[model samples]
Target: MTTGNSGSPISRYTKDRKVGEGTYAVVYLGKQVNNDRKIAIKEIKTGLFKDGLDMSAIREVKYLQELHHINVIELIDVFTAHNTNNLNLVLEFLPGDLEVLIKNTSVVFKPSDIKSWLLMTLRGIHHCHRNFILHRDLKPNNLLLSPTGELKIADFGLARAMGNPNEDLTSNVVTRWYRAPELLFGAKHYVEAVDMWSIGIIFAELMLRTPYLPGKDDLDQVDVTFRALGTPTEQNWPNVSNLPLYNALKVYPPPSRQELRNRFSAATDTALNLLCSLTELNPGKRCTSTQALLHEYFTESPAPTLPSELPKNDVAGGDSDDDEPENKRRKV
Candidate 1:
């Protein structure tokens, strides 16, 4: 794939403007000359590290190259510009993300609209899990919306193959807000439920239009989680006592599911049931992505709205086609 010796993939597109910037990379809105399709180019900064490529970039490239699904972001191409100290990734340009949509108070998403986004998000995640990959980091911002309103999982930088039993993996992979209790308790050998927990939180955020557990820090995250969901007990989660940091977890009596359900009066009872399953404290019992997709909430009266007909918002990935204002650049 090393094209530095000859031709470069960078020549095929016309970069229109910068879309986003981050500590590791800069994103540009570009168009392929042959077909004029829009694309987002993420140029990874290499000068900060003595190594040639960032570890997250390596992980992203390795996994995305192996998996292809409609709900996941497409990695169009990869190459390094000869004159620049960067690794550029050409990707499908999305209009906006769920975060911007959720944060836009002026926009009111119906139950079906929320269901549609959640359905697509789960489908994308299910694809990742089916292929033995774990998306350790899952949050509203990482869920990008295509112009058609289809939700696509993006930012796989923290994603990786699942850890087998008896092997140790980092407990600190997910963002603080969405980190599961098992991860908070420092469980080394965990499963894909970690991501499911995050999905549950995202579900709650969709319903409330605010973060479910907005902890100020890791410790605060754990406290808010137990208060909002429930503290894991050995009875509820059999292996709770065995986790590395179990002793450190606060001892809060589990909150009633009904109390939590009352918070989302606008949602159907079935919706609450699905959220309950996804947010279950026990990693062993949390709803799998497939179960989520098959949940009654989807088949109930208000079926998930078709993506193209959902509410519109003006943000990156909000609009599906041309005439969308060129995406504005901002730091990720």
Candidate 2:
């Protein structure tokens, strides 16, 4: 299938089967015709609206085409069908995602495994942030896992470049559970800290095997987040009250070190430190990707597992847990 100029030939890939469908695109599991490399073709329905191409599709192509990193999903090709005129994005086919592994009751997650995943995730986002881009959505589901165990960040539709200081960004981004306190408070002038908060929540999820702050709705999200991390007051978060929606919140005291310890029983002191740094109430105080990568948690005992050695789904001839050390096995 050929298209207008500047398009790759759709005939170069075979659409094996339909895997997923979204509001504007249908994803098909496919492979490259020449090398048989697995790929996912996101067929965008360009004719759906009078606006022509969807904005998300445009953003995905606009950004993914420029990013090239091992931890980021590769945008292999972009082409339009000769007859259908549909915009198709060819992406690396990641068979699993972090959310699937986190939800699977039988699969075990060791501390090293969590560290490894977190490390890879940070590496990926560090690349993005350094490029002045924001991965506005960073839930577990968006972090896809390759067959060889490398974790690659995906779903760039919600992503955008860092805006100017005077620019106002939408606070209505990121999933409710993973949304940062700044976003909840309606801070339009936010930065990379928002993504850090999502990573903190995902880290907690890895430890707890459940969502940390599962707010029912936006209003409830405000209550749920502060209740767990303490209400952001003028002292803890300077200029917090200046935000549009930062009024009349219940004043919950910050949890003590012991309290945090009890909450995350399995986490080491260094791990807890990193979590707190990431989820700090004040956006300015939250750790940057560089600081997080340099944290003691990653360098302390029980080193991060090699990507190839990290735990994965049992769907493909599961690993022999019998030979694993006791410390390496997750205690569920």
Candidate 3:
């Protein structure tokens, strides 16, 4: 909240090096001047747009300022640079992300390891949803990993607080691959179930060690999604035809239980149950974050591996200590 020409809040942190550059901002790896704590500074280019600043940058600042959780990225500081008047957000420095680990074939992912990541993701989103915030974009790349192995959900650019019943929300949110059936069908009014669907896809990705439903484009997304999960119809989805873009879609029979079992061969029955519930075609039927947290999948044998004990991106062997007594396992 401080402003100055030479002495300002921006002077409080040192930008060591530029790590990434996007259309609206440049990310720098730096440290807090006082404590020497590492941080990532996102320098927003204020002059790029005629309107002054990008909405994504505004949303990131607005939402992250209100959210505080171990599994959520912390917005450490916000300030405008002295002369250029450019905005900079100091965020916690996360060295790794889930996408890296998932794409790295050498890093083997155990059932428990997958459970830990999914659990952390759920916890983070649960907090957001409970606060009436929708993290429209929930994917592996947005889920960052701390040095201590904690998974923190990042990227609030596409996020917005849940709107009222009469308010029309945008259906064109969330990444194409992780998008929910409702969003795919162009539903203008959606609930937190959208986030649930993304988490479900992420869960599947973690288990398979690859993207589960890799759709080529928007049209192909619908085809690939339905071809794999089956087409949504009134019978199973209940009034799904009422949606804006529900017409003219190929119908594929829902996968048999055995088919699902075969698809996720290594998953436990409980794990599959949670997955199906989360990915339920109907937003009404999709599992809520609260319900998912309490699902039997978390309580069943082979409890979630401790975050610190989870596999590392650099560790090709992906060894785990699942053999440790369950009683010693503390909830994340």
Candidate 4:
């Protein structure tokens, strides 16, 4: 809505056009005048200097500035509007996000498509883990697909860099559906494994074309996850029983393996097996992003599709007509 000076250093190369908006910031399509490069500019409301910019927005900028990987969205520049007291973040503009693509396409993805996405997503998250960064929020909406169909993990608002393995951070992180079991059970001393859980959920979503476990609330979410994967036993998730919130709820016996196989009938055995390992109810038992990337699932036959090789436009048809109501479609 508001345009700043064209000649200013911060706004020098970028021409802004509105693209997306959210509760805390507005995203714009920005083009670099000199290079003719297009990028996404996220403008955060910063009039209230007393409270400072939102921590989530600040966290995104800080970590993304340090991370460099092809699977991660690139942060091009940072700017601030002089008179309006707004902070602007310039990012490489992705053509569309996975949510939009999945909704638009009727074409069924071959196992290769799923493998490519999973590989890319895990690689991105693995990069974060290597740097001690954890992407607390990971979901379809947060994953952007370039016009060529290469998947890039975006939106690091809820991401954090862990300082010490033993230190406990805030428990209030991650989106509910993609949250790890340790987080759900109120474990603040989590590791990169948390992001792996989300990747598992994303992997399952890609394969099924639907959310794997959609819980109405935190309690219900944990219930659904455990029900689908079977409750964690002492053997499977050792420290789970010691979590702060672990005792508040009654435990159910673990579900039969056949039940899981039946529920995800369309998934290949390797895919289902990996999902189960990643989504283990105990964070300790869950597979790390790096380990999942090395699994047999990705090593079969031809390598996954590279970013430049994916279908560009109209790969399917148009956006799906069965999109959920605006209010019900939760953003990560």
Q: What's each prediction's clash count? A: 10, 0, 0, 0
Error of 1 at 174 (Å): 1.1
Candidate 2 vs candidate 4: which has greater lDDT? Answer: 2
RMSD of 1: 3.5
Ranking of candidates on lDDT, top first = 2, 3, 1, 4
- Give the C-alpha lDDT of model 2: 0.86
lDDT of each model, Cα atoms only? 0.83, 0.86, 0.86, 0.75
Per-residue lDDT, model 3, residue 205, is 91
Candidate 2 lDDT, tens digit per residue, 38-137?
7888988887789899988898999999999999999999988789989998999776789878998889899999999999999999999999999999
> What tens-digit string does per-residue lDDT give for candidate 1 at 54-144?
8888888888888799999999888887888578878888877788788889998888898888898899999999999999999998988
- Worst 10 contiguous positions by lDDT, candidate 3: 323-332
Please give the RMSD to the true structure for each candidate, in Å: 3.5, 6.0, 7.1, 4.6
- What TM-score does model 3 achieve against the real structure? 0.92
Candidate 4 at residue 114, lDDT? 72
lDDT-superior candidate, 1 or 4? 1
Tens-digit per-residue lDDT, 1-332, candidate 3: 22233566776788876677778888877777777677888988887899989999999999999999999999998998668788888899777788877888888888889989999999999999989999999999899887689999999999999877899999999989999989999999899999999999999998888899999999999999999899988888898999999889998988899999998999999999999999899899888999999999999989889998988764322223122121110111
* Runs off by more than 4 Å, candidate 2: 1-8, 316-332
Each prediction's TM-score versus the true structure: 0.92, 0.92, 0.92, 0.88
